[model samples]
Target: MSSVANWSCTATATIWRSLGKDETGDPLGYTEPEQILCDYEGGLSKKLASLGAEIVVKNTVWTEFALAATGDYLLIGSSTEPDPVVAGADEVRQVIRYGDTFERVADDYAILTGI
Candidate 1:
């Protein structure tokens, strides 16, 4: 099946992932997630990008990929964009979990697990 970006990403969410501060009170850096990162029901994973320091993640919503209407799997790096990314399966733009409530840790990134 082919990927589609037919849906408009009209919604936006602001999540506060706890970041550790240095002695000067600056962010040490973003944390990484353990287990599987999910968006809605979609399990998102990280992939390397051509752009320097940029990363991509899956935008899938179904456990079974074939079940999804279209593959829009996409972005994670402090993204200000409102919607998910639509790219190749081997490639992806990560997403944030709207329903997820993460257990903040010192060195841990935000894990998007939902009920």
Candidate 2:
């Protein structure tokens, strides 16, 4: 048997999801702040578009969260706080589940895009 170390960073941020617009065409809101263990990182790159526009590609800020023994609260399209208490800060992005098959050992990751 092997033991894995727990995450050293803590992230506290609001999780947001679009609940569709109201009759007046205004967007509704639903969010909740939660603290969880995670790791964060960011990078940047530059690329030229076909239209001769200089496009700056900020590397996706990846946030990895260890899976609980019970495997709960993991969903794609869910956004989390990119700034973990341990270090680094970035904008919120959609969640990316990191695995091909169903397993509790793998971690859940959030892909932060520069918008």
Candidate 3:
């Protein structure tokens, strides 16, 4: 299959990557990582918004950082998050799902749906 062209990774997203489970079994995460620039959409349809999809991020299959995960939280800016785990009232999108569509056609894309 032929490789598809890269998507417009123009949006700079500041992310707090999930560091897996901690010793106390609490969710642990930090912001030593930022996702490579990708397509980030802030708005969604009413139906989608009702379904908890507050924001959408479309990233390329190839990236410099790790793929998006369920526990990861992100803010669509260049600012860093000191403690996303303890982030209080800050409006950030938490990645709920990650999917990769690969094909010979122009459908190769990695998508991260956040809420």
Candidate 4:
């Protein structure tokens, strides 16, 4: 299938939030992690709220964050652009064929590749 066909499904960021505990396993209405990384706070909260959970974004990072699986709520990003990458025309064309966006974050990712 063409990259565009694959991308037809849309790109999203899956976010999970940890709900504060009330001493028992139940949620205390507030989240313990206290923050989420996103490009937009209101948009993220609105999307999460639609999923029957409320999220308060404390901050946003250009890169994605991974939660440790103790999450209580979940959210998917609504971004249309793909993550950037520095690649030659062939590489870029290949990615385009898969309908994937290749964003090149301005840092040398070689060191962070394994992390």
What TM-score would each prediction reach against the true structure? 0.18, 0.40, 0.49, 0.25
Q: Model 4, stretches more than 4 Å misplaced?
A: 1-10, 14-16, 30-64, 77-115
Model 2: lDDT equals 0.38
- What lDDT does the true structure give each of the candidates? 0.28, 0.38, 0.47, 0.26
Consecutive 10-residue window with the lowest summed lDDT within model 4: 88-97
Model 3: colliding residue pairs? none
What is the C-alpha lDDT profile of model 4 across 1-115, one tens digit per residue? 2233233323333332334567677754422222333232222221244457644443222223333233233233432222211110001000001112444322110001100
| Per-model tally of clashing residue pairs | 7, 0, 0, 11
lDDT of 3 by residue, 80-115 (tens): 547654442123333333333455343323434333
Question: Could you tell me how far off, in angstroms, the CA of residue 78 lies in candidate 3 after the best superposition?
Answer: 0.8
How do these models rank on TM-score, best leading?
3, 2, 4, 1
Looking at model 3, residue 115 earns an lDDT score of 38
Task: Give the per-residue lDDT of model 1 (tens digit) for 1-115.
Answer: 1121112222322222324568997644332321122223245455554566544333333111121111222232234433322211222233322321232211112222221
- Give the distance in Å from residue 101's predicted Cα in candidate 1 to where it truly belongs: 29
Best by lDDT: 3
Judged by lDDT against the true structure, how good is candidate 1? 0.28
Candidate 2 residue-wise lDDT, 17-86, digit = tens: 3444699976454333234444445466555656787645343333444322111222223245432211
Give model 3's clash tally.
0
| Model 3's TM-score against the true structure | 0.49
TM-score for predicted model 4 compared with the true structure:
0.25
